[model samples]
Target: MKISTTAQAGALESNDVLVTVMPNDQGGVQIQLETKRVIFKQFGKQIEEVVRGKVSEMDVDDVIIKVQDKGALNYTIRARVQTALERALASGTRD
Candidate 1:
């Protein structure tokens, strides 16, 4: 339900969804989300750049997000962020 320590401290992987993780210079982390869209995918990169936070930053670390998306919608992206965060939380290990 919350961001798992393993997920937070591991690499990113995906099958249908493109997963990517980059360690920030600061002791923070971020998860970027996007559907299979040319334009949205481009913006997703930028979103990753600005998005920054630690699991502790969230008031509660007990949540996972699963987004049903067609193209990369802003709402969808946000949903995916939560979904992926949740995925990371539940996932025992980050591969």
Candidate 2:
């Protein structure tokens, strides 16, 4: 059972490549993603880690993620990236 967090509106830019993929730890992976034009610079890594670690195909490709980014942080770079994956997994959507 995959689940998403409250970080949906985190994306600030209209179109960009912001995504992080990784594996889930709990019984099921939980995705936590968000985006902003300028979130705290410190949070960028947290976002990246979420993406890199949670976006790959694990034991079951069942993973979770949270993307919150702004133009300032590399973290902002992957918000949409994650979203794209989510869309694909959910409805076979594409960029």
Candidate 3:
């Protein structure tokens, strides 16, 4: 799925994560992740892998993704990214 506009999901609350998806003019998936842990360098890779997998499964290409993790699990991150992508796709169709 192609992202036609910017969309986001989830919250900053503990055990939750916020995911944002936006159109990328340069093409390809770009991911930015923020977390409070000092081990973000490691967790960031894990988070990126999860988002990349989901976007690939959804057949999405050329978009920017931003993730804010508040102690959320891998599954939660995946769900939030999926939700954001879906919302982006839905909004695109409505436009």
Best by lDDT: 3
Pitting candidate 1 against candidate 3, the one with the higher lDDT is 3
Candidates sorted by lDDT, best first = 3, 2, 1
lDDT of every model, 2 decimals: 0.39, 0.46, 0.90
Per-residue lDDT tens digits of candidate 1, residues 1-95? 23443222212233223333322334334344444576455665554432333233343343322222344434434443544455554564554
**lDDT comparing candidate 2 with the true structure:** 0.46
The regions of model 3 sitting more than 4 angstroms off are none
Per-model TM against the reference? 0.36, 0.30, 0.94
**Per-residue lDDT over 5-41 for candidate 3, one digit per residue giving the tens place of the 0 to 100 score:** 8999999999999999999999999998889767486
Clash count, candidate 2: 25
User: How far does residue 88 in candidate 3 sit from its true spot (Å)?
Assistant: 0.5
The predicted structure with the larger lDDT, 2 or 3, is 3
Model 2: per-residue Cα lDDT at residue 11: 38
Residue 34 error, candidate 2, Å: 1.4
